[model samples]
Target chain A: MIENRPLLNLISHLTLCLGVLVVAFPIWIAFVASTHAPEALNSGTVPLWPGDRFLLNYAMALGLETGQKTLNVNLISMLGNSLVMALGITIGKLLISMLAAYAIVFFRFRFRMLSFWLIFITLMLPVEVRIMPTFEVVADLGMLNSYSGLILPLIASATATFLFRQFFLTVPHELIEAARMDGAGPIRFFIDILLPLSRTNLAALFVIMFIYGWNQYLWPLLITTDEHYYTVVMSIQRMLSVGDAEVAWHLVMPSTLMAMLPPVLVVILMQRLFIKGLVETEK
Target chain B: MMSNLSLANIGKTYPNGHQAIHSLNLDVEPGELIVLVGPSGCGKSSLLRMIAGLETITDGELHIGEQQVNRLEPAQRDIAMVFQNYALYPHMSVFDNMAYGLRNRRTPKAQIRQQVESTAEMLQLEQLLERKPRQLSGGQRQRVAMGRAIVRQPKVFLFDEPLSNLDAKLRGQMRIEIKRLQRRLNTTTVYVTHDQTEAMTLADRLVVMNAGRAEQIGSPLDVYHRPQTPFVAGFIGSSSMNFITGRLDHHQLQLGELRIPLKQKVDFNGEVIVGLRPEHLHRGTDYPHRIELDVSLLEQLGADTLVHGKVPGLDQELIVRLKGAAPCEPGTRLSLGFHCDELHLFCANSQQRIN
Candidate 1:
């Protein structure tokens, strides 16, 4: 911006285009494969162009009765499960983390710092590291095939809580004092002032957390054994496992595209707020 | 309705055992504006906060309207505060900001609307009622803050250096606006500021604080003319009061080789400090007490000229404020006269005014 350099701009644009193509190449391949029949992709090297079976493949993937039957679950039900799990995780995490951060930052109770640090320590332990014990706890609690089993364990992470705590600390102390002088109690202050001020952070975190919940492969695969509890993301694996024969690449590709659709749509729709939230929260 | 507020031997010591405010006692009459003026860390703000119930009193009792409010919360204390930063809710509109208190108190919706509209009209913030705080200028934000406090209709108003954040011109304008508003409302108010000019202009009674203690409390002119302690004398006036150490002998004060007769006889005569205000020192040779000073620096402010110099044979520098411009170059000698009654005498050790 400071100096107009044509060659530098050219190089930058070229690099960006290359990065975009590299990222978009796989999705394009998936789309092409989904449009073709199983016989077209069974030969050496997958087809890179669409065939006449575009409507047939998507309809079979979405319909109750289809050409390939690896799993008994329908595409609509799997999509519904994914949507529910993502919404549950996003809302649950936001609720619990905001309350925890509020209590830790505003209240003067004993062991407040200890509690904050205990929550902060959870950042070091990802779900992948504690999957076995978490799954066992879910099974013991009989929440294995429910939405709570898919959402609650993932909501226990400290990232959102820490972000909220950092944000709450940056809010001017004078605002809190003024609210107190205005006859607003703690609940009123949180509802009237704190929540509205945190709108951008909430939106940004929603985008991240929704994608996190939607793209969960290992957790959903390990927890849900029932066909009705299958998320679109985990159902892709079930379609791939065709037992002692060639896999149904066409069906698997369409389901993969379906699994990736909602989160991609969310990111695209809230791109402005997502970018603003990300930048502001880092401050 | 207005109510008298009193602090009886109030004090604050932090948990770490650092005492920020000494036992401070003051009786604020109803509808009076008391300005607490001091340097930073002098506990003026702490005293204001304690009176507002934002800070706990570690020592004594606070009474508002004949009720002991030591254990009450800030909201229950019936006091509204205008903070230095304005503290306007960035997310709320100006109307919402002003109406927040009444809403919290569960006032009827119709009443809240009427009160907010009236207060906003008073502050001239009606046009900005729908705009957020961030959309307003510094002066507008300040008015919104005042509107927020005014809508509450509390018994007392607390201001913690509210004008410290504005620019010089806006501060002057807002100072007059605040004084006028307070006069119209007639609410018992406690305002805090480190700037003495603001304290002098806005306060009905000024409390000059130093080192966590009130050095003097009186009307602005009374404190300026008759300061009780050396700290009060030095802090109240601009450009500072010059003090000269000399020996008091019988009825005469001996300044090295210069001898000046005292109009009144004093009992104690060993060592004393003579205080002289800059404005009191006139550029003439006719007055009873005259001294020749070797001019060191001259600052020409359009309305008045500040002469910084030293008395002959004295190492201490003395400043004289002369009306209009006096184009006297440095290293020249000038004879200045001051009245005998204008001299302030303090004990050399205790720094307490003697005569």
Candidate 2:
């Protein structure tokens, strides 16, 4: 900037524009595809431009009975299911990770390090690798086809715990001592001091975890057998699995757009806090 | 209200077997400001923390008023501490930060408000009460930290280098402010700082600590003039004391080639280290003890001049403090004198005061 490198600045701008194009192109195609009728997309290389069937395709997607027997499940019900699952996972993970990190960092109980390492080891074993066993446990507990089966297992990851722990460690030891001098016990300190200081981290983690929970496909696919329990992301696959037809590209594309809307809105609205949280938690 | 604090043979040893504080004892009178001064790693902070109930008293008992408070939490000990960093709650308003303790105690809302408002007014933080700590200046934030402690009206006030984070000019101003506030509040206070100036200026009674033990504890002047140990003597004064190793004979002190007779008799006659303060050295030949020096360097401070040089056959460097600016060059010869009463003789082996 001091040297006024116009050429370099131009090059950087061009590179960023290209990156944006690469990411946005798919969503653009999905939008175009969702606006067309089934026959419009079935013919030669799918249409690049919007068609006249926008309301028709979306209406079918949100309809309780789409008139096609195979795709009878309502997109409205699936969206509701996704919202519940995302909120559950985000809140559950934040609470569990925060308390765990606080205990591990502040208290000097026996085997504290061992317990921390044990929780940290869960980072290595992702939910995907332990899917069958997790599913079995969920099934045995009578949680199959329920929201808990879709969310609880995925909430047990170590990423949030580690982030909270790292943030807690960076807090000055003096604050804790001062709080103690103020006569605040552990819970009071957490609510009064620690929680307020961690606002950005919580907001940022919520964004990441909400997206993580919303985009979950394989976990929800494995657990939820009942049509009423299907999340939007997993139910998209159900819509495309119509046996002999050309995969209802119009209906599937609209559902895909709807499925991605909530997380995108969340990220866009809370973008400032999200970036602050991300940068601070990493520190 | 103020209460006396008593520490009976208190000690601290970390879990790794690092003995940070040995069995230390001190008694604080009501409304007294006791300062614990030392170099870092000297366990002054550990001692303060133990008294605040932030650290475990591994060996002995601690008493505040009539209660044995060694097992009590910091809150239960009826103490409030102002940290070096000011430790104002970053997200809370100044009023909330001060009111947090009272709220935790379930104090009535009207009472909490009145106390917080009065403390804020006392610290002159009334206008900044609604501002978060980040919005305030360093000195303002420091006052808020003090307000937080003062609002509690605890039996004891603990300060752990609370002014160390300020600039030098600000530190001096805050030092006076803290002293005035402490006196006005009349609370039994224990302050810890490594700055000798703070220890000297603010302490009603000073405890000079070294390597986990109290080297000497007395009034500021008492500790400065009659230090019980070489460590205390060196640590208390602004300019370090000049020490000359020599042999002590019957009623006489023998330096390299000069034997000066003493005014008083001493018990031990072995080798001893004689300490003389720089200010005690005069430019004229009016004192009973005299020494000549070859000046190697001169530092002319506006009000006083520091003459750094060495005496013949003396291995250690000697410094002389002369009043005002002295027009003297390096490599010049000067004669300095002191009284026998100004001399502090310490045993060579034990570093304990001999007379």
Candidate 3:
């Protein structure tokens, strides 16, 4: 499709190289800040060079007494919380959404279209507004301060459902037909043909949903009152405000950097797979 | 060994009440390539789907070798299909794609690998086994699709316009390849295509379809030479058979004041269409089909020349095939002629063949 384009040819290699650096600036800042000492951060005399406080920051964030909750801000517990939330959401949502998408895209049902539209319209309603009612529902379920309370309400994701539905829609209806002719029933056909064909798309969605599940702040904060239920994002916010005289500059920087690492690494690693998956969809 | 496929009064009424296929009937003998050829809206694909059990037989029975498969699922039909887009799983390597069905059936790994490798070798896809579909060319992908089907070793093979996605040159190449493969396997193959050339060269018998119904079923040559219906005549040939409104009077077909020799004699012939193939026309004849035609255009395709010209009182210009290149200019006058036996007469009102 790009064969006839002479316009792209006119763009020079140097300009393209410059564009790469522009995108890398934020990532560079995260790493640079991560390697520095808390004193440099506290002095507000931003260092142009890497400092030797990497160990100091780590020590402060992980320490039990003054360094622990002051700078580190119980981030280890928060990291554990985020892991539970992300994994629970990713695995649970993928299964339920896939089943929903398969039925909507491939099978005959009385209210298939209506079900699709209901799910699709959920893509619009901001979760911010639904926090109160959703919190009430989670509380009514008696899941307060529990991991279920953290993961359950948002576990049934419309985004993953929508993405999987789109991917399933593109699967050549022939493959499903072929699977049907092969004497395979609905579940067998989905597992054998549709799932195998959809690996790339699924991987792409897994990355997207994993990041979203990991980074959720507002809902987790609103639902769980227990500090034990604090997710990684909430831990970062807590660390930034942990002190009276001076914020634990020591633990705050490293803990914040650590909190952001998983999602950043996820994006970096899965970006190639995501791009390849997108192109495959066009094919 | 081959399998018989029969569709008995199969009709598909979609949920929205669109009858995509209605009361379609077809029977296939073992080991024959049955080609379903038709226009876009025709339900050729639907009929094939019904036979394969990919689609439910809405109001009838579908039998594969005496088994009433109306309720049988697609996998139970014991048939494999080659899709139009080749539907080779995009992310899988060619070998994995071909081996998938056998693996699903729990054929041992060694046997599955051997079958897939052998099928790949046959399709000349050995080198392409490790490659993903995106890496392979269109023709290679098509071969991989065929390999996937062949590896199943099913009772029948269903092809839904398998070569439609390739370029003309590759399509011609793949058509020959597919026909040769089908001949070797002698599977009871049902190929659905709208391309007349594919239908002509590949089908042992052609099922010409229109609007969810079969129009005619016969050998490619039989459908071409003795078209039972006017649609078959117009569809089977390129430079589609010209339909000129004329009166079949005794012997000759009188179009306006011009007359062409038509050997058919009918009792009642008030209004009819004279179906003349482009190749059937001639440059010389004694009892000539002489018409004063203006050369609208000429397409010289190396071996033969297509003379596009208009006759007097006709709203549309017609095309005539000339053997070898003809040095004809636009707006020039030319005389065209043909024998009386070449004329195909059809009722102008009913659109059915007269002779």
Q: Which one is best on DockQ?
A: 1
Q: For each candidate, what is chain B's TM-score?
A: 0.98, 0.98, 0.94
State the DockQ of every prediction.
0.67, 0.61, 0.40
Model 2 TM-score (2 dp): 0.97
Clashing pairs in 1: none
User: For each predicted model, how many residue pairs clash, with residues at least 3 apart or on different chains?
Assistant: 0, 0, 9
In candidate 1 chain B, what residue range of length 10 has the lowest lDDT sum? B261-270
In order, the first chain's TM-score in every candidate is 0.94, 0.94, 0.85
lDDT per residue (tens digit) for residues A1-283 in model 2: 2767899899999999999999999999999999998878888787889999888788787774556432456888889999999999999999999999999999989999999999999899978899889988999999999887888888875899999999999998999988888778899889988998899999999999999999899999888879889999888877877688678888888889988899999999999999998775421
- Each prediction's TM-score versus the true structure: 0.97, 0.97, 0.84
The TM-score, computed over Cα atoms with residue i paired to residue i, of candidate 1 is 0.97
- Measured over all alpha carbons after superposition, the RMSD of each candidate to the real structure, in angstroms, is 1.6, 1.9, 4.9
Runs in model 3 deviating more than 4 A are A1-54, A64-75, A124-128, A192-254, A274-282, B15-17, B249-253, B258-265, B285-296, B310-318, B327-336
Ranking by TM-score: 1, 2, 3
The ten-residue window of minimal lDDT in model 3 chain B covers B260-269
lDDT of each: 0.90, 0.90, 0.81
**Residue A95 displacement (Å), model 1:** 0.6
In every candidate, what fraction of the native interface contacts is reproduced? 0.86, 0.79, 0.45
